[model samples]
Target: MASYYLWRSKFGGLSVPEAKRLKELETENGRLKKLLAEQVLENEVIKEALRKKW
Candidate 1:
């Protein structure tokens, strides 16, 4: 337990609310990254379709 707290504080001594906010931010970041990846894939598909001689 002591070692755990020591490691936790070494990384970040965030309080309860701060830790909660950090978790929320991390979740939001992950969601946004996934959305951006999907959008980029869609754009690439569109570009490929447009490039084909029709």
Candidate 2:
């Protein structure tokens, strides 16, 4: 797909090594983002529970 290529191009230029590194970094970045989101949601739920105390 044209859109897929367009999005993939944003990672790196013509070098294969660069492209591989870019993919690795993107994968790590996504994993870290997911972890952060989970922690944020957990914090919110705990906060809500605390707010309900008499």
Candidate 3:
């Protein structure tokens, strides 16, 4: 969000260190989102399977 950019600017005006950290955080966020999405998909599949039997 906007707060993130403001914090980054205070550190070093988006210098190499800030950029590297940002990239690392972004990658972590992406991995987490993917994991969450996969879980949701699995839940949906399980629900559908149960619905079919019931």
Backbone clash count for every predicted candidate, in the order shown: 0, 0, 0
* Candidates sorted by lDDT, best first: 3, 1, 2
Q: After superposition, how far is residue 17 of candidate 3 from its true place, in Å?
A: 1.8
List all candidate RMSDs to the true structure.
3.2, 2.5, 4.7
* Model 2 clashing-pair count: 0
Range of the 10 consecutive residues with the lowest summed lDDT in candidate 3 = 6-15
Superposition error at 29 for model 2 (Å): 0.7
What overall lDDT goes with each candidate model? 0.88, 0.86, 0.89
Q: Using TM-score as the measure, name the better of candidate 2 and candidate 3.
A: 2
Alpha-carbon lDDT of model 1: 0.88
Global lDDT for candidate 3? 0.89
- Candidate 2 residue-wise lDDT, 1-54, digit = tens: 998889767854547787888789889999999999999999999999999973
